[model samples]
Target: MVGRGELTDAAWERIGPLLPGVDGRGRSWRDRRKAINGVSWGSRTGAPWRDLSERYGPWQTLCERFARREADRTWARLLEHVQVRDDFVGAGEWRVSVDSTINRAH
Candidate 1:
């Protein structure tokens, strides 16, 4: 059961292969979908990683996976892929709003 703000089946199908361990080289110790959902939940709700719901598995693992992806530029690649796909499919406006006031470097 995919929740609101979580990736849909179609979306996952497109994005899953972009992630590590989908190539059958090695087993992934964690469930990728759940980890991704946890990341999404934290980012969308602006919740601390430690506060992620258990259904997404260990918060630390999810946070680490998110950070690893970020460091490796996976997130940026995913975004670019999605944008291209959406453009080809004629998907409507993909707008993003950022509140810089909440983004102070500390």
Candidate 2:
């Protein structure tokens, strides 16, 4: 069962292939999707990594996987792919919001 903020099977299908595959010489990593779900959950809930649910595997593992993906620009590529596909399917709506107010430190 998909939990709140976790990627659905369809959503995972769209981005799963974009993640980096494990090298045979290195130690095998945990499931990419589950780790990613942990990331999503943590970000959405604004929770600490150490508080991650065991259902998503160890928080440290998820953090490492996320860092590796970010370092490799896999996340950027996945964003581009998803944006392009969503635009093609007429499902994308781009928007930007700016808060122009500046606060001075007292």
Candidate 3:
């Protein structure tokens, strides 16, 4: 059951492999999807880390996971991947247009 601010299965499939230790040794960490969902919840709601819901497990763990990914530039790569997917689907052109009119100071 995906939570309110969680990625769907398809999305998780794309992102999960990019995270650490999916294929590594030692005891596996908690569910990556749930940890991501907790991070998403915290980001979307601006809630205090300590206030994370128990359903997502320890807040500290989630925060640390998020921090690790951020430090390693994983977040940027994930965004780029999603953007590429969007481009492939013909979602829209990636462009920006700006219009400006300036008046001379009197």
Q: TM per model?
A: 0.79, 0.84, 0.75
Minimal lDDT window, size 10, model 2:
21-30
The sequence of per-residue lDDT tens digits that candidate 2 reaches over residues 1-50 is 88777899999998888776775646665577888888888878898889
Winning candidate number (TM-score): 2
Clashing pairs in 3: none
RMSD of each: 4.2, 2.6, 4.9
- Candidate 1: C-alpha RMSD after superposition: 4.2
Alpha-carbon local distance difference test for all models: 0.85, 0.83, 0.82
- The candidate scoring highest on lDDT is 1
Write model 3 residue lDDT over 1-106, tens digit each, in one string.
7666689998888889877774343356768788888888998999999999998898888887788779888889988988998899997478876555554556
lDDT of 1: 0.85
> Which residue pairs clash in candidate 1?
none
Deviation in angstroms for 64 in model 2? 1.1
lDDT of 1 by residue, 44-96 (tens): 99999889999999887788778878998999999999999889999947889
